[model samples]
Target: MVELAICSSNFTDQLALLSFKSSINFDPNNVLSNWTQETDFCGWVGVLCSRRRQRVTGLILRSMGLQGTISSHVGNLSFLRVLDLRNNSFHGHLTNEIGRLLRLRLLVLAENNLTGTIPPSFGNATSLKIIALARNYICGRIPTELAQLPKLQIISLSDNYLTGPIPSGLFNILSLSYLLLDANQLNGQLQAFPNNSLQFLDLRFNELSGPIPLLVATNFLISHNKFTEIPLALCNVSSIKILDLSHNSLSGVIPQCLGNFSNVLSVLDLRMNDFHGSIPTSFVEGNKLRSIDLNGNQLEGKVPRSLATCRHLEVLDFGNNNINDTFPYWLETLPELQVLVFQSNKFHGPMGSSKTQLPFPKLRILDLSHNEFSGFLPTTYFKHFKAMTIINETVGLRYMGESYYHDSVTIMIKGLEIELPGILTIFTTIDLSHNKFSGEIPNVIGKLYALRLLNLSHNNLVGNIPSSLGNLCSLESLDLSSNQLSGKIPSQLTSLTFLAVLNFSENHLEGHIPRGNQFETFDNSSYNGNLALCGFPLSKECEDNKTQLHPTPMLHKEDDPTFACGFCWKVVQIGYGCGMVLGLVMGYIMFLIGKPKWFVRIAEGEQQKKGKRSHKGGNRNGGRRK
Candidate 1:
């Protein structure tokens, strides 16, 4: 009788498991195919049982592409301790019966389509330690009962629709370490968090406002909030390493107290704020700041030369500010410097570098546009742009931004100034437009095959387009308009198959536009101000007599009469050759005759006619032909 009872209990657990498995709408991985009565429950996949009790203790179905909702029958597995179903397509409200699992400790339903509110009854499961339901469609404010779990260490409810102020009791959990509640509709001022042991806290992209609490976090991201200034208590969090307080209306000068964490600070982003006054020059070297973005601010004064001490600096943007100073050439000393932006600033003077060592050797994005920069472009700088010379496809495809922390930059790509958070490392560009820069563009710029944008418009640049520009096969946008550039456009530029935006307007360019690849897509606006340029998109035919006779090629249209072959073409070619030979013979006979009487009379008549015109001009303005 005892053996039969044990068998009946085991069979009851199997029935519950099969009932939940049947609820699945899709199981592309066939994870539940072996969950049948023919096999022992312990031998089934994703079902772990005890060695003696034959009861399920763990059920892991992470990233199995499983779909459908949880079944209430899962509560029958009284011994389950771990239940993981993350990174799947599971939907529908979570079964309230999950609260029946008194022995459950780990419950991860993250990265799914789960909806509905957290069951208040979940408080009965006092054994729960980790509950990660992040990146889902779950609604409603977090249940107050969740704070009752004495052993709960982590609660990740980020990237969801959870609303209302975070429960103040949730902060009372001393065992919690990681609390990420960002990218949601949660509101209200931040409440005092009593748990001092929390290490990672991210409340970004929320409706949080008011002063922040004094929390010592290793990685804290509270940006995109309504805070008016950096928390004064941030000075107390000596353990802070990654701190992003950008995109807020934080006014007033930056706190000098930030220098206190010189030994622990690695990433400090204070971009898109209202901070004014000179940047603090109290920085030290051991901080390991790899990225510093202070763009779109009211900052003035020279770039703190003391920043040279940070040898690991990779990205620095101070564009769109009132900063008035020469270029910070000393930044080149930092080996990892990759992005430099100083556009729309009061920075002036020629950007010529004389150091033997290449300045900004690893720079991939250089934006000095809309400034007062004068004189010729720094050709020497283009020659040493080794980073842009090599294509880094993997950097944009795999790693969207810098390692460890996200790197943001505001640049004028394709024409408008846009801010890109987590900018891809492969976005190679050079924007020197709307400046007073003069002289010919250096041929060395063509060597940067990885360059995606090249904007040199609205400058005083002269000389013909460099034929070497054809080497940039990956270039997508080329803007050289509104300059003094003369001569015909380089036919070699047609090789850039990826060219989507081209502009050569308001220049002195002439001759036939290239007819292949991207050139065929350009409209008359691309060559508008160049009155001498004529092609398929322009109604004005080339007036060169040579082209009129031979019609070399108007965009090399195949249907042109020159490309036809027939009796008329053959006769024309024969007549042209004969006329050339006969003209040479006649010229020889005239030379032998030594000035024929008819020729002399004709020459004298032409000279007399010229003398009459000269006399008329002299009579009109006293011999000065105005």
Candidate 2:
């Protein structure tokens, strides 16, 4: 009887497994091909059975490209402990029957097409510890019953359509550690929580408002919201590592105690805020700080020299601020430093020559546009931008970041501000436009082969555009407009195949524009205000010495409207001369016949008519082309 009872239980479990296999309408990988009665159900591809009872305890079918709704019969597997179906196309509402698995601990369905609200019956699964359903379309408020789970530790439902304020009971769960609810529509002010086990809390990309409540976490992200202030209690948490409060309306001066966080913090992002006052200048030595972004703020004062203590620093941005200071050449000592932005500030004085031979050796991006800096381009620094000049083809693409914090930077590309989520190692740019700098662009700039965008416009710079710039094979946008640059557009520039946005407008450039490659794609707007520029795009045609010496006998399609009008005048002049000769000949004959007076009157009338006709034709021909 005992053996028969065990066999019956095994058969029941197999039936439930088969039910799940039947529900999957599509399995392109054929992962469940051998899931049949001929084979032992315990031997199935994703099946895991207990040794004693031979009962299915786990179903690990993650990332098999499986598509279909999960079968409700899955709840019949009473001994099921792990149900992982992550990174699949599993769709439709989650089966409420899954809540019947009393032994279920881990339920992962992340990166799927699953929709509808989470099953409230999940509260019955008391054994559940982790419930990950991130990167799905799951909507509606998080069920408060989930907090009732005695052992629930992680609730990862990020990148979903979940709404409503977080259940206060979730914070009360002593075992809960991570609460990832980012990229959702959850609104309302946060309530104070007395939890101590919570370590990683991400509520970014949401509509949460009001003052931030008391919180203690190692990694805290609450950006892209309307939070107005940072609780002083947050600074008291000495164990914080990553604190990103960027893209918020948080005002007032940054707390000085934040500098103390450098000892443990690796990333401290406070960008796109209204925080005024000078940056904290107490970054201690031996700090683990890797990325520090304080851009788009109203902060004023010089960059503190104390930052040199952060030997691991990689990214440093202070763009679009009120800070006034000269170039901080001392920053070149840091070996890992890559991105340094100070665009749109009161940074005045010359970028004096670096005393070191290889200053900013690893620097890939250097933006100082819209400043009061006046001098020639920093040629010496250009020579030492080893990161931009060298290409490590062996290394695959990578971004600058530290742990969970992906570094971001804002740059002006083609007259628009664009924010990059992460800075790739190979991406490079040099923007020094809208300054009082004067002098020729450096030829050494050509050596930086990895350069993508180069903006040197709106400056008092003079002299020829560097023909050596042709060597920048990766350059996409080149803006050298609004300068006193005079010379022929270098024919060598035709080699830049990747050039997209070219602006040479409002300059004294005089020559036939380059015709081949990407240059041919530019329009008259690119060469506007360059009166002497002539090419296919422009109405003006380049004149050869012969074309100037001898008038064109006929109008050409490529001829300028003004030149065609002149040609018309010349033709009229020739006809008028011939008519006069003919009239004189006629008069001579008429005079012999004593009819000279009538012939003279006819000739004068013909001359007046010819003049009127010529004047009308001139006006029509000289008008600007639409």
Candidate 3:
């Protein structure tokens, strides 16, 4: 009778596995090729059976490219503890029968095409510990029944269509640790979270609103919400590490005690808000801060000098503010600093000489545009940017952030305020446009072989375009428009095959525009103000003997339109779109930055009007001056 009972249990599990195999409409990986009657169900791929009962306990088929609905018959495995089908193409509603798995401990079905509401029946799985249903199309409110699970620890339902206020009971779970509900359509005000074991809580990119709740997690990401005001109670959370409350409607002065949290806090992002007040200046020494972003705010006063105490600082942005101050040259002492942005602010005065031998040794991006900075461009600092001069193969490729956080910043690119969701380490640029910097293009800039964009437009810079700039083989966009620069468009510049956006217009530059490589793709707008630049893109033709043209002192170079066709279509086509200048610019940036999603969004944004060739004046306060 015992043997008969074992055979009965084996038959039940075997029938369940067969039902699962039948439900799969597509199995490109042939994962179920061995799910045949000749072989025991225990011997199938991803199947795990116990030694005693020979019943299925685990079924992990992650990234197997499997498609179709999950079979409800899977509930027959009464002893099953894990069911991982993540990173596949499984579609249809989640089988409610999964709730029948009384022994279920982990249920992972993330990164799939599964649609429909989450199965409330999940509440019945008393033994459940973790539920990972992120990166799916699951909709409907989270079941309050989830709170009943005594052992539930992690609930990851991010990147889905889940709507309605988060179940209040879920927050009350004492064992809950990581609760990620970001990138959803969830709404409703949050209740003050009680002190428990919550460690990481992400509610970003949602419609959640109401007064901010008391914080308890170490990594709290609640950006892209409708929350208003930063409560002083938040400053009391000394254990918090990463706090990102950006892109919200928060107002009022930032809690001064936030600066004191430097010892434990690592990431502080509060951009795109209406907070107006002097920045906190109590950053203590031996702090752990790595990124600080306060862009697009109404704050005034000089940058806090105490920020220099952050030894691990990597990214700092203070753009679009009313803060009046000179260059914070002291920040160069930070060895890990990579990105520094101060665009559209009250920062004035010249960037004086570097205090250290290699100032900003790891600086990859420097944007000081739209400010009142005067005097010559920081030439000494350019040579010391060893990080941008060469690619660091040792680090491989990665974004500038910690494992749980990604550093972001906003900088002017192609006249648009582009937001970088995550700054890539290899992405390098230098924007000093709309400033009063007067001098020739620094020759040392050519040493930055990895530099992708350089903008010095709307400045008082004079002298010829540096021939050494040809050494920047990776340069994609070069803007020197509306300047007093005069000289021939260097023929060596034709070597920059990746050059896409060229705006030397409104400059005194004279001679034939380089014809070969990416230069042939640019329109007359690139050389409009120069009036002297003659080439295929321009109306005037270069003379065979005379170096200058009659109408304007145009440039001279051999015309070769053949090489222009070799440029990548993906990049070249972006320039032709009438209202996609933002996408075109962002795409090129994403292509270099190594992010796929941003590259996909490159097909959007405001268009660049080529018909408007009027010169832009240097009026920083008012709107664009023609």
Candidate 4:
């Protein structure tokens, strides 16, 4: 009994010494105040010991915001099995002496500021099963010595600056179930991935180039690299559930075999690549698919009808493509749809009526701009939308009465008085221009008192500018250009004190331009394309027009009937006609002087045919044929 007591006391002394040394380097706040030899080692703050068997088994001090180095004396804790010091400010080199803890199984040092190479002596801890050092500043190649740990199962070293080839030694670890090396500077051909026991693998955001290796992992991520082609071998992984290969330089048609992953795939992202060709009809047949991101590709053709059956789909991004077809009405039937981004495409047709329903009750973001969609703006589109930003610039959205105007006004209705419930008004903007929309600028637009920007340019809109627009107190930008609008410049617009940018160019507007704070800073370009407009910026004086005509409040027809009757009409018509004639004459002269190669080719072809016919006639004259 005496000899056994002596052996136990010796072990306890070693552990106490190690803990004391490590604490000295990190106890900046002195929170480990009671860590002393006089007190039993089990009484320490994070120290855990077996009750009946008086031996320390675990030491957990995670997220204490602790700072400083991990001392080498930590090796003295021979019986410690688990050490968790994650999510702290721990720094300095991970000491090689840590290998002395032969019984250690789990070591989590993730989310720290630790730097330096992984110590090779870690291989001596044969019992170690999991080691996570992710989101740290750790550098240097993974030591080949780690392969010696026979019982190792999970190793995550992601989000670090570690470089060099993925150590082949990792593949040899047959017990490794989860391996993550993403967001690192590692490079080399992706090969030798362990097929067995590996359930999860992430190698994303690396310098890896070449085809993806076939592995049995269920969750695979290898995005943001320079891979030039889809790894058909990935199709071999029948167990894959989530596959992400976005932001690569991959080109070529998406393989039809991708549909074969229907058995288990739930999320598949292949966005931002050079992929071209029609989207496969068989692509979304999988019932389990929850999310599909194929944006920023060159895919064409209509969306497949089968996608409507994917009941679990929550997000779908098919933006920035050449997809030319009518909007998919079937999309309105999706119950779980939350985010749908279809910008920069060639989709035509009206947003369906059923879309106004609560199909996407949880929808947060819906972007469908820069497309060929046409028709009136949908009023009920935002009834269930918590927040949204929809732009229809390239589309042909014609004005459909004052109701559409009210819909635009709803975006600015904010503050507690509006009783918006849980919805805190964030950013909501509308851009409707470069289309065939027409009619007078609606006076109701000013009611959207919260409006930040209003753009109505490059359209056929006609009528006097609405003075009520000045009510938009929050408006920062207002554009009303390239229209047939005719009227005096509204002095009420000067009331828009917050307005920073205003454009009223390319219209038939005439009179003295409004001056003051925001308008005074504007140059001639802001008021250009308007023939009769005269003010401080223009060389023509406002007094010149008032002197020639009698002051009439109703703007009589006799008062310069055609508006800019004498000056504008003559200048524009003569300038356009002369420019057109000049261009045609110059083109004709160039064609005559420098005969193109195509013209010479046509002449040569005609001469060759004539020669062949003459030869045939000569043979007939020589009595070769009757």
TM-score of each: 0.83, 0.85, 0.88, 0.66
Better of 3 and 4 by TM-score: 3
Candidate of highest TM-score: 3
In model 2, where is the ten-residue run with the lowest total lDDT? Answer: 617-626
Off by over 4 Å in 1: 1-8, 392-396, 400-404, 544-626
Q: Give a tens-digit lDDT track for model 3, residues 333-405.
A: 9889888988999888889999888789988889998999999889999878887776443443355676656
After the best TM-score superposition of candidate 4, give how far the Cα of residue 287 lies from its true spot, in angstroms: 1.3
lDDT of 1 at 541: 68
Question: Would you give me the overall lDDT of model 2?
Answer: 0.79
Residue 543, model 4, lDDT: 68
Query: Is 2 or 4 the stronger prediction by TM-score?
Result: 2
Candidate 2 versus the native: TM-score?
A: 0.85
Tens-digit lDDT track for model 4 on 1-626? 97798568556644655554464466666667677667776777888876666677787888776777776767777778998988777788888987888999999998777899999999999999999997677889988889899899999997677888887778778899888887678888776566588777778767888776666677767776667776667657667777777777888998766666665777777877888998766755446776677888999987887778778776677877999887676776777765576766887766545544564554544556567566544334433443232211222212111110100011111110110101112223344445445567765554444345566666667999876665554455677878788998877566555565667899999988876657766778788899898976777688655533323234333232123122323433433222222232233233234523222212222212112112111111111100
* lDDT of the candidates, in the order given: 0.74, 0.79, 0.79, 0.63
Candidate 1: worst-modelled 10 consecutive residues by lDDT: 617-626
Candidate 3: pairs in clash: 506-529, 511-554, 511-555, 512-555, 512-556, 532-553, 532-554, 583-602
